[model samples]
Target: MLAPLLSDPDTVRAADEIHRGLHALGVRDPHVQAAIAELPLEDAAAARALGRRLTRTGTSTLTVNVGIALLARLGEPEDVPYLKVLGLLRALTRPVVGALTALDCPTAALVWLADHAEIRALRHLIDAIAARDDHEARTWLINAPLDSGAVGPSTARRVAEAVQLSDILGAEQTDTQAVAQAVAQAGRLLSRMTGLRDYRPEILSYRQATTTYTAFVARAGQLPPTPDHYAILLSVALDLHSGPSVLLDWQPGQREALLHALEAVLHNESWTAVAESEPEDPAERRRVHWLRRTARQPFHRATVSRFRVEATVRDPADPDTVEARVLIDGRPLVPEAFGKGPANSPEYLLDSGRLRAAAEPREVQLAEAYCTEGCCGALYVTICREGDQVVWRDWRRPPSRQPRAELPEYRFDAGDYDAEIERAENDRTWAWPARNTARLIAAGLREQPGLLTRWDGQVGWIGTDFHDQDSTAISFTYWPGLAAGQRDKDGPWLQFVWSLPDDGTPPEHQAATALRQLAERDPKTYAQVRGGSRSHAEVLGFPWPEPEDPEVTT
Candidate 1:
């Protein structure tokens, strides 16, 4: 690819071809750099010209990255300003940071770029800034490392470590304001570490977990409680009390003392007044409500229990596969301390038999370990409806672990239990675009399974699954009534892939069109069906019988 850029008379044409070629092949920045690295560095002028041209005129991200990497290796210091401007773009941040770092750009340059960067981009620059003994960078990091957003909580731990939070908190001369901010940030970090659905590095993984948390608690005691402080204290306290003891990697008696200290600060008159006042701001009110509710109804509130269903990426490596977990009174329902693995998605966790109360005692898997049930272990609980109460009992541990503290069975009022279950299941507000698309298709298929009858003799609708950001698939149990597993070696399964348009078409319209087409035409005629299990499964593409009228549908 670079040979063409180096030899071609028309640099613009060569760059455009390389960009389109790499974009089509789905080659990313690193791949481009590897290719460029293999080429001779002697062509410094060509590299600079190609890099400058691509950086200025290239539309695709990969093209600009190639230019940036090339220039980082061969260009002059004059390219610094252009690279800084490129760093402002989120997609280009990593390569731009790399280019600047490669060129040995000043810490102030990186800090300037960090000002416009999101938490994720800031993450790339944090280590470089932290490594350099720049007071400006240190001050900026200590004060503004985190923001109040989804990415903020996940990145809190990294930022805390970059700024050496434990040392700062432990120092006698550390500024009071910096100490307070770091403590509050630690609280958020701890909260994220305690989360159940997401498979994140535990709070204990941080070498300074004990020192940081204990120091935060001690300092929290000295400060007056504000509404924000109350929320942080309450959140940390609730998780510490309810979460697994393993997460409490504090010094002996430190956990207990911290809890006592938090309780005192939280129950103090100032905090109580803030909680009771119910501030007009919605975010503040919600925080206040949590404090008020926790104060009134301790850890395990009787009569009614609150259930919040949250979806977390099961593996950071694979963000598409989300795992859903239930929050029982704001603490994870799954005992994460027991080496629990990721649970199924929202539909599988809530709609599956696990959450339903039946007359007969039925066992269900709450979570599995990382390896699997056979190799590692899994958590199981039995549920049965006894009179007007639904009781969960007979907790089973995975076969491979040591005997840890047993989780007590929960008993809930049937009415309250049923309502909570339905509420969480019905709430689709947390769903992503792909999930919403799957749900829309699933609903339509449930009402009309006959749409796929012509595809095969024994096709049974299983459920919808997310394929990617813009695609979803509806799978089915495809027995075919053949000899046992003759048709599908791994039992019976078939899926119809629905690739949605990039034009901002609403999900309802997409689902309606797909359903109408399935009903009108025989899927077997147009669908390209391939056989095998889901891992290697080749899904049939859902066909469009005709062009859809945009104005006719919502």
Candidate 2:
């Protein structure tokens, strides 16, 4: 009966019958144990029988070990579920991970095991995957939920270490998809850990840091070009201004390599071109132009700081007029006149003006005092005066040769613009025509920090202490575009203020504030000082103030 059961073509059924018979004969019986151990493990029938015996309540450690060894040796991918159950019960050991690896377990299975498995077991699984040292295994490891903080710190550390090691190997692998996957995974991890949401910069740097991009580009270049390749290259160029991150530490020769890759992508005549030549499609032309511009600029680490417009005041004598003043890094910005001008000449007068005039305020203009080729252009504001006070009503770009139909008609409210700026800063993809729109907004604020008035279509100049700094602010009154009947209401005009903060604010703001004071007290010399031409410390005539650690303030 035992021989017939063992010899049956149905391996699972035979194993079950043998297990029942062995149970009836007493599992602890040395004869029964010997019989189970002696069964041929190479055959599916014998291996199932051993597995059944090992799972039984009274199975000995020696029998369990033997069963696991046989299963590891003979298990097919289908057998992984059963082996995993046993693995969970016995603690996921090296042998179990090795068996799973051998079975070519899917990533889902490994992840499921990770979710249910003990920490030690998970670490061993990570090691097992890393040990495979191939693209698929490395890709799986790259996407593992190690940073989810579900695991203890020690385990997370081990997993991170394993991934880093695997990444080094993954970077060297010839698989393009796998390498891209690794780069994306590393980028995501770095962004999450650093509280940064944009990973384009890091993704672009992967080729330089890991050689993954280099490998991918070489393989991709050999194939028929796809839109995906164009997109990849474009992404690299567009994000060139983004600084390096922990995972994508820039290295020597990386920038040059990136430029070469851009050129290679451009070499595909169907996608982009050099010199005066351009793609026929306007959108394609724009894309190529953006790429070229980004490549030319590259990434320059600039310390940006934030400032706020603390107040907009009416000149005591002029009720319809207001003067703009900004508090940057906690100091007031007063414009200083430069060039060949006496103390109160037009050049000096241009440095300050009436924010509004005594008329029905319809429009206001703000011009940058230093209108050089490199400087940003002017800002225009529209306004309406309420009883006893004035309020900024709306913002419109200065008229240009571009057809009014081509210009966007949306009037920007200061409140909305402030919110949008904040959103754009956090999410680079916040709006269509994102970077350009942001650039225009920033330029308007930087170049024209003061307000001038337009009454009956004629322009009138106004003055404010608004001036240049590492940071500055702008204020505008919003018009809701109400009906004629609704125009005479309680809140016809709303004032909104916005500030551009340094990359790290408050501290930078304070430093900027100090510098502003230094510049203002000695305008003759400091008026000529430009931010990039000299160090802030040298220009300020003192050591550059360090951002306070822990950032305490008065």
Candidate 3:
């Protein structure tokens, strides 16, 4: 494709003019790559000059892409500097990264460019770093795996594999700083590897995760309690409690030993003091509060039952929603196990009628259709507390749904089930503004269900909507209509919108106001709402009325 351009003695050789010529000639990437691959030595030198010139001076992305592709095939190490410069343009990251990798770029230059590269286009850079036996690259990966924000938990495994994390952890010559950094990185890595995020690999992906965690616990005891160390330890501790089944990948005693070690360090008086003080960093503060809110519980297996259950907050942005997954004998009981769709939202599972054991066997909805629940039906398993055991049996789907074969029943240690539920419930690290409002309102209703008696409704689902730039509208969905206290098979739904200021007003205070408003207001006076309509609290004359002036008679 470039034969005519390379041979023309009178052709304008300026980078822009050449770029324009290439565009005019309708040259494509494959044509350019093919022509560069077959070019003669003298012609290759001229092409390299053209590639270098265009890469350095061209403003158009198409021209720069062609320049970088040429360099990737025929350029030398001397071109790494300019390639690194061009890597800054996120638009040109992929082509520039490829070019830099092909030129045998210095490890430092590669690392610098990788820092600026997007995670989606970072595999080549990571592989380039991994290919070299460079200590610098290994150290960088250990200390600051997530620092650049170039890679998230989803892509961190690539970084872990690139550094040969398992080899480093098992090596006899690994130094203290490297081990410590590895421990910290591994904690963050494992914490995310749990089934919380879709497409993220589980902790089993890393063979040495168990060792790194144990090492982290040991290192924590040796160092003075700090926000960073405490945060890492606390996060990993929560993950151990509620993440995927550890015994599936860990040795028999390893899970207990690591959990015990973590408990010791996390609950140490000195560490507790630091955590209680509430560190300034937002992330650390969230991590530390989990321990602050819950009592210290022992990490031990109560019964020999093989059932393990965990509530996963798959969507942190929607914190009020969660899903429950079970592992029997270290094997997942997922939707795919029975040809179902996905798991149902377990947000209301803790309401004494779902996963929480009850005196009578309760048929709980476990998994549901990927589409609407009514259309494709849901999966149900009967759960009940039988003495020291939490038994799950009679696995079936919605009436007439497939899977005619009866699935096996499971009996979990009641102690283990309760502990896991508590851990998952207390995990407020995923909390946000909307969830906070919902949580407070839910707590208030739980404390006083009769508060909505005047309205003749029960809270169904609580959510929030953007009211304005500085405030939000807390919405509550109630069942069986309002006022008349009527009931039917399906029942009707009503919504109340409470607009609250974002001026740091306590959520509990908002909850209190909402409760009081619900108790005092006559739902009959409010306009009937249908579809997506909502009754605004301010319009209903109940928005935290201002204090009245006290009389001097007092």
Candidate 4:
């Protein structure tokens, strides 16, 4: 009876009814389970039917559980996409979770589900991974794509950290010495992974963007009233700040909805103060906020400003030769010295060391100028003059080394002075948050010294600082031999210090204290550090300690 129903495409309902009756009879029927499990994994219809029956309104709980167990045992990776569709039904939650857990390779299934499953189902997968408290699960969770409509980066990071902490705590209970050694090693691994520095302006931007997105979406009726819709909107908004062209095909209303959402999201007392200080139009005020946020994004930081091509000089030797001395806001536009122009004209001089009077004066604009302090000193633009109005074209970075003429151009009017200045101002705001995030992480580590002692490479190292300068100094001594390249030099230990701002002084001290505790608690790491290289220590601003004798107990 089961064989005929299973083989015939039209007998799905009959097969399900018979299976349900068997389930009702307390027949933990191996034959039925075997028949279901033998169905072709590629058969989406069969999988969907089983999945639907698992959640059917009148299905017995035992039947659903039985179906889940069978699916878990037999479902192939190929069945995942269809299963994901079934996973969307709230009624199937228990069975779906069971099936996911039962898969031979649950990690791959979870990842695929996270990417394609509905938000609730994705969350279920995340929760399941978090509960497992294992390295492979944590790593997969950490590497899972957060760009999916279901999960945002901030949430993903939090989940990863939680799972990491759980794993660390679990390990610490079993073996203190081993966990301590792992923690010390994790510090070194994390330092290398993030270039031995803690401060990340990009992370600050991500946090800020996520905050703004959450706030705006909470109040904005424009987005669909679902958590998944909110997550997607937030991701889309962040993408917009980085690159506006991604949303070029969106309706004006949609773009404005996002921008308006960002506006509400980023509005703060400081912005209010800035607005109050300026006598600008409401439209300009909004543009200022947009520009300010965009400036923080690496993709949108290339700024365009209005300029007047005061004079053009044509080399008498060549008719096609042209040079222009541009004025930005009535000031002579002097390109940065040693600045390389765009790749199209690498050595092309935008401003001659000395000014040349223009034979032909026309208003123009410059786009993609070095707007940030650490600019690579390049000027890229599409300058156009229409009558008395000068319009600067939005300059997109070329995909490859392409000639200037081949670069794509889009219209960007320079009439929005307020917006341009806002972007320029935002370029200077990155340092504060970068410093603060580092301090916050450091402070957390200081409070929980045990956390460092339990660090496993499987869990992320969140408190490691990225770079240090001497202007403000916080120092720690650690055996340099523990670090990757420092094992061969004549040093028992190396002192690592970072120069932070006056405001960062306390956190830097706290970080140093935490490092000291880490070094003292982990003898294995201490032994490795004792053998570190002299040169590596010197680079980190520490004189190498005296070389350790091979037999010395100290």
Candidate 5:
């Protein structure tokens, strides 16, 4: 799955797009070089996105630097310019940066620091930076003494120059203040590079921390819980596969809304059926609101020093049997920990039941894991919807009735459902470009007005039988109706949840009728309709009537 990226022009283009944007920002030279350096460090797709961010509109040096550092781990050149760039970034206050850099840091920075940094001041500065990071960045910086030839003003001269006489480690220059600052800064950088980014002693402890952190992000209500944040959370989850209950601090009754939007973002599937016209600022805000209001889950709030949410699976049909357990801290958290969706996660998890594909559309199964279980760090946990519901029973189970794409949520004004479906469903004439299903529906109702409400017989020899609310087949019931032991085989897979539109009626009506006619015209469309119990079983397929529209009447 990760292979195609090499030749995928879109990915290269996305990467190119980012690089161009980076050039426009003040980060053109050293920054791009640094990112190029990190390319060997991360995955190609990640590298591409990083390049885009570097090149994207109005990207900050900090953003570019982060991109470069992560990419470098994928395996970028460790060069002079990259090192110089690293020296420039050494001036920030983030712990994550340190560890990330250590994975694929610009090689040049460490060498220069060893050569020219003033000894007395080094201790103080490194300490300052390390302390700021809660000791995370400091843990990774071990000593590799300066070589006499390592010092030079050519590539990263600015680094040497800035090493304040205080930063200088002279035999006699014993300024405690200078030494303290350098020490702090060095320590901070080391923590980031090595053992500090959310390091922990136990897995359960990390889960507790994750919940607390997530809740913090949720409660702040200040940040947008922006798409990028969602993406990071997703990446973290993919990395974790299955971690502890990740409690998130969310405003009471707010977290639910983000789930759907997150789902779409994670899977790259389109959810364009939103009813309300949306504004440009937040792409899926409306959809997010809908999901939150209607997520079919059993979750309750737990409050103590902070607020958090605990979700439990109550629906028998819900496939993601295991739910994410999360805890929250009332305090506001950072943006990276905020939402449930992210465009950046490598593979988006898609919910099979929610997919809306047209009939016979190519099948696309999309579900990917995220995470490892060494169990010691700021873990990422997410509620995954992809393939959670479909227990694909491998080849043993019959093929599914669920299509890969979901029909856009159908809508209409009162009586217009028929008009809309007619327009959406069929058009018999291929020569007429503008021909729609309008004629077909008119013909169907004028002929069999009760067609939508009618049902003929069971679809095939199946394993289950079900009853319905109305006389028509839209509603149904099922017990043990097994032909070859396949569910929905006798019916629409027998009580199978149809993924099509509700054309003011159940699919059974149209489906039964369509089968009859398809057989009449072309028996090949459904060659699998051979039905009968092993002994008394005979071909019990729908009868196909001949005509322009089988279900339609003049």
Candidate 6:
């Protein structure tokens, strides 16, 4: 694209005209996008004019894309915030989100795209950015609350891997506040997502790009839409969020306290939700009613949900230079991160409870995923081999007590719980046959990637996020066809579960042993299951591999 532009004046001018036409019509210029990627540089007499344009002329989103290209070329921290703003500009529409990915600033562009819920890919990119870094970029991602696209883990890992390498190579400085703001925005969005009820593929749409569902009814088929059940189960999450009172009514006071809080949300009338809603703008200026919580609970406060994505040069410059994963509410699931591809997946992972993030390239290595800066912020997850059973430990927690069951909600929305708390709410526990897997795969345009490659495809299989039994926690789900033969006795299965607690773990070294036990039981499971964020999979099962709470106390 650049060679043509630079070599031929006609090409350059013609390209300029194309940009003009795209601006006129509401579409981004893919040609302009490619040109910026290929060449971006202009030095004035002054070392820093604060602005040397990527191209002298373009629309707002185009301008932002050009600016992002310029920054990637210059690799300056000063440009991060600006790029962030530009990203916000383009995020308002679909055309921009699709065009921004080819540039080196996929992370920047993705942050902008996922800010709104109107488009499905927005959540896929959110998983990529949030899972990739612990900085402010992740903050933006968390605030977006993806569209229940199980691509969380796959996309998160891809972005995380890229960020880690860039940091190791000193590509970018740590800009905490900027990224934190992003995370906060993403989290707030998730709280309100309960309104955009999950779509039931009970009917696939031959054409579905309009706001008026009524008008499309004629064109759209009722034969289970392309992405029929791809919507986040917020309207259906009651299955996991709800539990019998006795499940939490333990002798200890903490057990009772945790149970009561969850019940409040599971049964609260205000928490009542309508899965689908009319499309409306939810920008920073727009009064996103859900964000304006009447009251805040620990489920919303003490906890923070983010994706810790990481991609590496195990080789870059490859078709998919990125790998990612999504962390739901707060948990990370390596299986989905490495198995599913997120860039295009319709549904994103929301059920993962924890993940291990890597910042460097190696034949094989494991790293603990970091929680946000808030309350000593959960555990820095670590897993290791221990006999036939895998085991885990919180490098940051006390060696004495380690949590294993799913974690408890940090804050409960006092908005509408009771009215929504029906038996279905309590029964939604992790997508059956693997809710995360089914929902994430269901969102894609083609046969799920996992189905095509588990072991033979170019990238093999990338995993996405899947919830175990907890809305705030996640458990690893298997990639279709990704199989591992045993060392003799009984080889590990193609897919397996590490029943950690979404139950209720404290801030300290709570579930260390449980995680470690998981690693030991099936050391290869993580490798076979986890890693990568912009990845999705194809599987066949329902509520398969039910995870048990790996806690000894309970």
Of the candidates shown, which would achieve the greatest lDDT relative to the real structure? 1
State, as a TM-score between 0 and 1, how close model 5 is to the true structure.
Answer: 0.21
What is candidate 4's local distance difference test score? 0.39
Write model 6 residue lDDT over 1-554, tens digit each, in one string: 23323233343354464456546766564544566556533442111122224322345555445434444444444444444444444342333333333334546555554553344445545544555455557445433443334333234333333333222222232665443333222222222221112221111111211111122112111112111111211212211122111122234454334424343443334333321222253221111122122112212332222322221111000011111222333323322121111111212111221221122211211211222224122223343333332233333322224354542322222112111222112323222222233333323313343332333222222232232222222234333334442122231223332333333344122334333333245433333333222112122222222134322110
The candidate 4 region of ten consecutive residues with least summed lDDT is 313-322
lDDT leaderboard ranking: 1, 3, 2, 4, 6, 5
Q: Regarding TM-score, does 2 or 6 come out ahead? A: 2
Candidate 6 Cα outliers beyond 4 Å, as residue runs: 4-28, 31-56, 59-71, 74-85, 88-125, 128-132, 135-554
On TM-score, the candidate that comes out on top is 3
**Which is superior by TM-score, 1 or 5?**
1
Q: Predictions ranked by TM-score, top down? A: 3, 1, 2, 4, 6, 5
Global lDDT of each candidate: 0.63, 0.39, 0.59, 0.39, 0.29, 0.30
User: Between the candidate structures 1 and 4, which one is better when assessed by lDDT?
Assistant: 1
- Give a tens-digit lDDT track for model 2, residues 225-282: 4333344444343232222222244466665566566566556676553423466864
- For lDDT, candidate 1 versus 6, the one ahead is 1
Model 3, 87-108: lDDT tens per residue?
Answer: 8777777677677777877889
Residue pairs of candidate 1 with colliding backbone atoms:
none
* Candidate 3: residue 298 Cα off by (Å): 8.3
Which stretches of candidate 4 lie above 4 Å from their native place?
Answer: 1-238, 241-246, 261-405, 408-497, 501-554
- Per-residue lDDT of model 4, residues 483-548, tens digit only: 443444454444333333333345446446545645456423332223236766566454455655
* lDDT at 288, model 1: 57
